[model samples]
Target: MELSWSTFLLEILNFFVLVWVLKRFLYRPIQSVIARRQQDIDARLAEASAKEAQARRLQDDYEDRLAQWRSEREQSRQALEQELRGEKARREKLLAEDLEQQRARSVAVDSRRQGEQRRQLELQAMEQGSRFAAKLLEQGAGPETEARLLSVFLESLAEMPEARRLQLCAQLRDTPKEAQLQVASAYPLDGGMRNKIEQALTACLGRPVACRFTEQPELIAGVQVSMGAWVMGVNVRDELQGFAHLAPDSVGG
Candidate 1:
């Protein structure tokens, strides 16, 4: 409680000395340590922020690449489906074409078979008709028929073309031996008929002609005449054979 100036002044002086000592050694060193720790904290925080930004950029890039991969996969699927459809359509078209060609071939083969059958039928009819006629002609032969055929033959020879008559005359004259004139009939001839034939031959040859007569029943109903290499006949058998040999097309021709 006693106010003493000296004591107070001395106390004030001690207080100033304590403050200078704390500022010079303890306070200055603690402030330097705190400033260095603060600088280290700020540098660590800046580094953490930069690493966080890099991680976000990496995540965004990964998302974009994933999206692109999904889009490409879908496009590939669509293209593959379209290609498969096109291939199926093309194969179907080819199959259809092949089937049509087979149908056409079948029709052509059927037509050909029908034509062959028709031709066979025509040939059969012609053969049957030929056989029937041959039998009918065989039943109708006689001396009377032979006489008529011989007379017709003589008439035809008399009315022969001038050129053909001349050719026969030349052939007969050029023979190395005497042109042998052989005359025959299916039926035997009497004296009167033989004289008539001889006169006709002599008139046709324009010269005197010698004759050799014979009977030939195979002639079926006719006369026969030969001189050297030349032979003439008017017979049912020969005419029937020529008719049998003719085909349907050749009959009209």
Candidate 2:
């Protein structure tokens, strides 16, 4: 083919025109579509990243709440355990105190019982001793010796206070109406006893007194004083009876 300047120029113009049309129309529109697509993809990627971040935050929050709940539960459990332990300790203490009190009460009761038994034993021993002494006194003093001793004792008693002497005189009365004092002896009246009787009667009656003695063997070797309704007899048999009354428990022994 032979080259022509006009043809070549036309071809060149055609080529440039195609390029301008593509650039001004097709190329520009396609480029705009591509740019918009790229923007959409970038927006989708950003949204995805944001959602992932939100999910991660929510998970962390849930984990934190779970941990807090677990911690609270553990604390409550520990506190409950401690409360139970304290209650158990308190109960044990109370039980111990009760047992101690019971033991103390038992000890006191036993001690009291033992003391009572000891007192009873002591009383029994005293009674026995008194009886033994009485028996010995009975065997030692006879009727005659007892009479002589009674006369001396009366003399001493008469020398006591005036009230005591009057009381003696009153006790000698055999009855309430017989207030006068009288002294009588089965044996011969001794001067000493007679004088002592007179003095006692003089003091008792506040006047001169007289005492009579009659020989009566049936009265035994003793003196009997009668004052009205009252009569006092000094005899070994009476003394023995008084000794028996003093030690009633030891009488059988």
Whole-structure CA lDDT of model 2: 0.69
**Cα lDDT of all candidates, in order?**
0.81, 0.69
Q: How do the residues 216-235 of candidate 2 rate in per-residue lDDT, one tens digit apiece?
A: 54444466666556556665
Error of 1 at 186 (Å): 9.9
Highest TM-score, which number? Answer: 1
Q: How would you encode candidate 1's per-residue C-alpha lDDT over 1-253 as one tens digit per residue?
A: 8999999999999999999999989999999999999989998998998998998999999999999999999999999999999999999999999999999999999977886677667666777877676667567878888888988888987898889889888878865444557887878999998888888878887888878998887777888888757877687767766765675555334
Give candidate 2 misplaced runs (Cα > 4 Å).
20-30, 126-253
